[model samples]
Target: MSSSASTTSTRTARPVHTTPIQQPPSDSTSRIPVTPAVLRSIFASSRTPHEERSISRIAFFRFAGFLLSCVGISLAASRGRGIKTGAALLGVV
Candidate 1:
């Protein structure tokens, strides 16, 4: 009985402090938007290198070009003499 009575129970936990804390780099970069308005905003963002220009910018440029072409063609056609110009002027053709 003498040897068994001398011992006392104790508890221990596993070491949990080995992980080092790390801080992320500062947020100094501009973010890109992912919306329909992004197409419009992109032009105002920067004068980028030609090779790095985005596809959305190309699409917007193409659409503007197409609209201008239509306007020019309509103007030219509207100037035709007599029947053709009359049809255009009346908004019937």
Candidate 2:
């Protein structure tokens, strides 16, 4: 009984005696935080002027395709076709 009581007391006291590890506060400006200017600078340096124009052209076509798809789907739906069927025709479903 005395050994068991001593073991229990040692186990409880060990955790109470130990201090929690802590980290020091970090500096607010230590990191180069990403902003819009930082993003533009990164892109500007990574791509040539021609490559940038090609990328913009691809993006424009993608946007135009999306608009065309919306128009097609609306026209189909207005023509008494099910919206799901129209979307399926556009491979959207």
Error in Å for residue 56 of model 2 = 0.7
What TM-score fits each model? 0.34, 0.46
lDDT of 1 by residue, 1-93 (tens): 466566787889877888887765566465454687786567546655663466658888999999999999987876666677687879999
Per-residue accuracy of model 2 over 1-93 as CA lDDT, tens digit each: 455444444444456557777875598777688899899889978999999889889999999999999999878766897677777989986
lDDT of each: 0.73, 0.82
RMSD of 1: 17.1
* Residue 32 local lDDT, model 1: 50
Candidate 2 clashes between residue pairs 3 or more apart in a chain or in different chains: none
Query: TM-score of model 1 relative to the true fold?
Result: 0.34
Top-lDDT candidate index: 2
